[model samples]
Target: QSSNVPKLGTCITCHGRDGIGTSPVFPNLAGQKSLYMVQQLELFRSGARKSEMMNVVAKSLTDAEIEALAAYYEGLDPGK
Candidate 1:
C-alpha cells in the first residue's frame, strides 16, 4: 500500500511506543475497536472532532494506513 504522509514514528510521539497512551487525555489505542478508531480518525480529519494534533495527524493519513495503524494497536496487550 502507498501513503502520502511521512512514516516516521508519528504515532509514538504521544500514544507511546506501545500504543498505550501515557496521558489520560490521549485515549489508549491499544486493543481499541478498529471501526471505532477509523471513525475517530475520519472525524478528526473532517473537523468533526476538534483536536489540533489529531487534526494535523489524521489529515495526512490515507485510509489504508489508518486501518493498518488501528489493527496494529488493537493487537497490542495494553496491560503490559
Candidate 2:
C-alpha cells in the first residue's frame, strides 16, 4: 500500500519535505485532517476543485496512492 505512492520527495516539492508548507499560500498539510485531504484530492482529480497544479497531479494518481499520501501527511507531528 505504501509502495504505491511516490517517495516523500515527490510530495515535498510543493508541500514541503516535512509537509509544513513553504508559505502561507500553501496550506499546512502536516497533521491535517485525512478526510479533508482525501476529499480535496478527489475534488482536484474530478475537477470539482480548480487548480492547474493539483488537477495535474491528482489526475494521474490512483485512490490508493491518494489515501497513502493522506495518511502520510496526516501522521506528521506539525509542532506548533
Candidate 3:
C-alpha cells in the first residue's frame, strides 16, 4: 500500500481495509476498475447517484483523493 491509500479511512467502516465489504449492503470494492470507481465516486459526490452514505463520504473528497482511492481499491487482489 502507498500514500494514495489510507491505512484507516471512513471507507473501512463498510468496505474493509482489504476492500471487502463488511456488510451485505456495501458492495465489495476490491479489483474494481479505477475508471468505474472514479465515475461512480464522482456521481455520488455530485448527488447524481444517490446513496446516503456514499454521498456523504464522497462529498468530502477532492478529485485527487477520489482518484487515489480508486487506484488503491483497483490494485487490491479480490482473490485474497
Candidate 4:
C-alpha cells in the first residue's frame, strides 16, 4: 500500500521529483490521467510499447507496484 519509497528511488531520477520529466523526451507523469499511466506502464512491462529502457524497468515491477506508481504520478501536480 505504501509505495512512496520505491517511486522515489526508482522513478525520481528520470521522471523528476515533480514527475514533470528531466527533459522533453521523457513524458510528464505528474497529473497525467491515471488510466493512461496504468495502460502505458502495462504496455511497457509487456514489451508492447517498445522502449528498451522502459521495458527493462517495467518488467521488474509487480502489479501492486505498478498501480501504486501510477496512482502516485496521477496525484502529483505538474504545474507546481
Which candidate has the top score in lDDT? 3
- Candidate 4 residue pairs in backbone clash: none
Looking at model 1, the pairs that clash are: none
Better of 1 and 3 by lDDT: 3
TM for every model, in the order presented, reads 0.84, 0.86, 0.91, 0.88
How does residue 1 of candidate 4 score in lDDT?
29
Q: RMSD, each candidate, Å?
A: 3.7, 2.4, 1.7, 2.1
TM-score of 3: 0.91
Q: Each prediction's Cα lDDT score?
A: 0.78, 0.82, 0.87, 0.82
- Please rank every candidate by TM-score, starting with the best: 3, 4, 2, 1
lDDT per residue (tens digit) for residues 6-79 in model 2: 65556677788677878777878889998999999999999999998888888988988888899988988788
Q: Model 4 over residues 8-65: C-alpha lDDT tens digits?
A: 5677778877787898888888999988988988999999899988898999888888
Candidate 3 per-residue C-alpha lDDT over 1-80 given as tens digits, one digit per residue, 9 for 90 to 100: 64546433788789887889998988999999999999999999999999988898889988888888888889889999
Error of 3 at 38 (Å): 0.2
Give the total clashing residue pairs for model 4: 0
Superior candidate under TM-score, 1 versus 3? 3
Those runs of model 4 whose alpha carbons end farther than 4 Å from true positions after fitting are 1-7
Evaluated against the true structure, the overall lDDT of model 3 is 0.87
